[model samples]
Target chain A: MRQSKLVGTLAVLPSFVIVAGFMAFPVMFAFYISFTKTNGLTYDWRGLDNYIAIFSDPIVHQVFLNNFKFLISVPLVIFSALVCSILLFEQFKGWKFFRVIFFLPNVLSVAVIGLIFRNAFGYDGAVNQFLGLFGNEPMQFFIDSNYSILIIILALVWSGFGYQSLLLLAGLTSINPAVFEAAAIDGAGWWRRLWSITLPNIRKVLGFVFIINILYTFASLFGFVFVITAGGPGYETTTIDFLVYLRAFSSNNLGSGAALAVLLFFFIGLLTLLQNRVFKLQKDD
Target chain B: MSDSISSRLTPRAKWPIFIGMCLVAATIIYPLFFVVVTSLRSNVDYKRDPFGLPVDWTVTNYIELWDEYGVGRAFLNSLFVSTSAVAVILILATLAGYALAKLPVFGSKFFTATFVSVMLLPGPVLIIPIYLVLARLGIVGDYSGLILVYVATGLPFAIFFLTLTFRAIPDELLEAARVDGAGFFRTLWSIVGPMGASGIATLAVLQFLGTWNELIFALILVPDAQMRLLTPTLATIGKRFVSDQPLTSAGLFISALVPLLLLTFASKYIMRGLQVGLSR
Candidate 1:
């Protein structure tokens, strides 16, 4: 029995070392470093200064607002995914092929997706070429602030709706077909059935997608911003991650960068707690 | 939207849904088609008519990209890092996840919570101290450093996934193997490995795609031009070749190739893996 316990310890030791070193430790260190100003590996304790600066900074304010603005993608993604999933759930014809192709973008590299989106909407790209057929000039999509954010959302929807739809499809699959059939027998139209049977049944899945999309909008916008706008025209579309990259590494301002990061950590932590709570409340899946 | 009732609907009702789906599929396919066509064309041909079918189709961009540009090296680096990390992830996650699931390991519950909670840590910010830690260890420029980071980050999902997968395996099989004089490693190798093959394969495919597509960590950890990965190379070379669409598209095609191949081949596992993650 003692030897078996020892063997179990040996088995788990490698994973424990890596996780503790990389993930667990850094989180605690992020809190520690956030409080102090640093220069050239020299640290000076400056309590709350870093936080106050970022809070008061207008650029940081705009970046947070940009994140909130990007939250608009959540509903757009859900609505698009919901409609597609419902349609696909119908399994009309070619649904299998469509399902496969739809999942492709979800697995694609962000760098590649960002490039494709950039090219598709670039001044000399396809959208412009189509617009040119009507004698209109090519439009600059990335350089402008409003258009840049819009394009990112469009790209997110393009890449994400498929995955979310499949999730909804999974949810829709679990829902006993009898419910839909019974609703139909009771004179429910498609919309009526969807609202009463479909939507209500899939709320848990919807909530999951909703929270993840929100988390994604916060955590994973870096590649798009880095590749497409480069946070351009003047930090207009810069996401928190991109800003952290800039503030922490590029400008060599680790102190305040770490400060903003700690704030982001708490924000994401709060959101995840909320997600856990939602799931706990639902307690279904 | 189930079978018995939908089967009663006339074929006429299917048209709108069919066309709408086709339109959605087109949104995905058309752009990719344009990318493939553009990559195969000469820059001048692409330049002369961005919308036209290629009059001068050639693999020159791909050939030149491999032979002259640093893409070949980046490709190799990406392959090595992704494969190495996936291998490590499989070994580590399997052993740990197996223990957590099947063994009377001490602190199993605590270990599980520690790993899972790490998943929710904000990545963009989390990279900072991770970078600092790697730098502190002076492994920032080492392939081992980047590989370790990938393995560490990927373990949570892989372990969590495998835990669920392993929990489904009946204990009687393992007990029988043990009763037949099989030790822990032997049972794990002959029994658990084969039994859990599909789930493990699903994890490998998912992790490989993830590591291949990763950008920021590779960018930050391995900054040397000689050691860069594919996605970050795209960012760097993307800036350098903004005007040369064919060459840039060729780079895009190269970086996107493996995951596309994985998607094409292991799409069953990919689909299963993705749908399964919703339970988390």
Candidate 2:
């Protein structure tokens, strides 16, 4: 009996070790290092000086603000995805074909999507050429700071919409068709049936989507910003993640980078907490 | 707000919605079209007529990207890393998943909870410290280092997923194997493993996709040209060929082809996996 127990324990040990070493330990270690000045080799305790540096740093402010700006797209994505899923729910002809086509971008690498968007929005690129047909002059999309950030957000929406829709479609499909039919029998219109029945049924899924979307907007925009803008226009497009990369690697300031990362961790934690509270309130209601 | 179900469900009024959806679909797929068409054209031809079919229809850009630009090496590197990651994850996650789901291991609930919490650890937050860990172990810029990171990143979800999968197996099958005197490993290998084949395949595809398109870790860990994966290598290529649209397009298309093909063939499994990941 003890021998079998040993084997069972041994079975889980490998994965536990890897996750503990690489994931759990670093999280704790990063928190520790954030309080100290470290440069790969040595460390000196600074006692919140690194955190102080983050507050005082204007660039960090810009990064934070840029991330908040990016959050604007969360609602936009959820709404658009909801609409697409509803359209797909109607079972229109070629609906499956459209679903697959929409999801094509999600399958492609983000690096490739970023690259494609950069090329497509170049001054003499396809978009401008299309605009030129209606007599619009070629505009520099990536050169301007505002336009640069706009392009990054647009690229994310384009790449992400399909996956989000598929997820919502799954949610929508899980709702019993009988409810809709009953609403129809009760003389409810499409919008009424959707609002009073379908929406309520998928509330859990929507909440989950909201939380994941927040997490995604906060961190996963790195690939798009990395390839398309490289946080260009003098760091106008730099996000917290991008700035952390720049501070730690590019500027070789490990302490500052760790501090910034800790701050991002806190931001995500707070967002998660907020999501929980919001959902809890809804559940109570 | 009218009650006539047929009025709403009839195909006549749905054309506009359908057409609108087709346009949305076009927007999603248009960039791919642009890239492919641009890839077949020279820089000058693309610049001259961005929307038009390639006048030149040149294969030179692809040849250059593959041979001279070393994207071919990056492709091989990505394949090697993803395949290696998938192999490691499959073994480790299977063992851990089976043990957690079926075996009467101590603190199984605690271990499963730890794995689930680990999934919430954001990728960016680990960049600094994981770099430090890799450096400490002297695996910096090494393929093994990147593969290790990939396995760690993929484990939490894979294990969580496979635990659910393995738990769904009728306990009777496992009990039957034990009645036949099958050992722990034997029962897992002979009884539980084959039963979870689809689950395993789903995990493999998802893990493969994760490591294949993983950029930040590859960018941070493997700096050497020979060791770089596809996405990070493409980023480097993106920087170098900022103005060379045609060449970069070819590189992007090449990077996209594998995952696109995988999605095309196994989309049902992929979507099913995603539904499990998200909704569960």
Candidate 3:
């Protein structure tokens, strides 16, 4: 037994070492740095001041709200993906072709997607040309903060739905054909069979997709906002990540950035736990 | 009555999917077609007809981008970084996953929990600290630093999928190899690795995709122009050519081509691989 234990420890040693050296230690170091008013390598301990400044700053409040805005948009995008998946789930001619095309945006880098949309929404852009048909003046999509956020949301949905649709398609495929056949034999219509059979069976996968999508969407806010707007028009779309980048790099306020990082960590952690609980209950049911 | 209702609904019910598929296809394909057309059009023509098909197809945009924008260097850099990161991730994740799945690893639960928890930590959360660490090591703004960060970031999901794949391999196969007098490494080499080839390939594609498309870490960690990857190069093009519609469109399409080709060729494996990662 002791020999087995030794062998087991030996087996896991490399992974443990790597994770400790890289992820865990850096996380703890960042947390420690949050309490200090140091600029990068300089060490000047200031307890609670960094945290206090975050709460007092109006910019931080705006960033916190922007982060929530990004988070809340996930469900809307996921819902569209769900509907798309349902439509694409059935067997049809050109199904595979359509699948590839829809998933194309997901494969492209977010930076590239942002660039494409940035041009599409610019003055003298394709979107303006389309709107010109209806006799409306060309509106500045990027200049207006509200429209900028909306444009980002649309891009997010476009890039995001493909992957989620693919996931849901997988989930849908896994459902037993006989169940649907049986529902039909019992005189159930398409909506009835779908409501009674498909939704419940795929609920677990849907929940998992929701959690992953939410986290991914939140993580990606920086790239899109950075590439397109740079949180412009007076920081209207400045998310937590962009704000941290601004504070740390732009303004050289490392201490405040670290504090914001810590808060962002806890916020994401709380959402993850909540998602886990929701998934767990669904699984148990 | 139920049979009659079912028969009546079958034809009409398919319309929703038909409409949905059409909408999804248009949304995805229109932008792709737009990019391609714009890339082939002259700058003047592009400005005149931003939404129209090119009257004369040409490769000038691509040629100019390659010659002027340092796209070739960025492409090579992206290739180098992605391939190196995927190679490292595969080796480490495979060994770790096999050990966890097959061997009696002590505190395996804790290790699994640790890796999964790392997934919960958002990518942006690590940017500042990782940058600081790389700066301390004096490797910031270099390829090696970016590669290291990419490997670390890709490790968790790679291991997660590999562990599942390893666990699915039959214990009887390992026992059979052992009965033939093969040692652990020999059994792993001769038996386990071949059996897990498909899984490994899937993971490799995923690791490659994730690293190739990663922009945030690449942007933050590598400040030098020569070291910038393809995504950042595209971002630079956007910054430089804010009004140059054709050039921007060409750059976007050029940057997307590699990943698009990678996906098209290995799409089956890519889809399977993504399913594994996302499911976990």
Strongest candidate by TM-score? 1
List, residue by residue over B1-280, the lDDT tens digit for candidate 3. Answer: 1233332345566676677788878988888788888888888888676777777888888889889888888999999999998998888888788888887777789988988888667876787788888889999988888888887777877778888999989999988886798865687788779999999998887788788888888888889887788888888788788777788888888788888888889888887776775555
Q: What local lDDT score does residue A242 receive in model 1, on the 0 to 100 scale?
A: 88
Look at candidate 2 and tell me the lDDT of residue A156: 78
Give per-model TM-scores. 0.97, 0.95, 0.93
lDDT for each residue of candidate 2 in A213-259, tens digit (9 for 90 to 100) = 88988878888889989888887888888888888897655988998
List the lowest-lDDT window of 10 residues for candidate 2 chain B.
B1-10
RMSD of 1: 1.6
Q: Residues A1-285, candidate 1, lDDT per residue (tens digit)?
A: 777777877788889889988988988888888898874277889999999999899999999999998888999999999999999888887898899998989888888998888877887677887888899988888778999999899889989999999999998888887776777778878778878888988898888899899999998999988888889879999999889988977765688888888888888888898899888966754
Q: What are the runs in model 2 whose C-alpha is more than 4 Å off?
A: A1-3, A274-285, B1-8
Candidate 2 steric clashes: 0
Between prediction 2 and prediction 3, which has the larger DockQ?
2
The deviation in Å at residue B177 for candidate 2 is 0.7
Error of 1 at A220 (Å): 0.7
TM-score of 3: 0.93
Worst 10 residues of 2 chain A by lDDT: A276-285
Better of 1 and 3 by DockQ: 1
* Model 2: lDDT of residue B14: 80
TM-score, first chain, each model: 0.96, 0.92, 0.90
Where in model 1 is the C-alpha error above 4 Å?
B5-10
Interface RMSD of each: 1.7, 1.8, 2.8
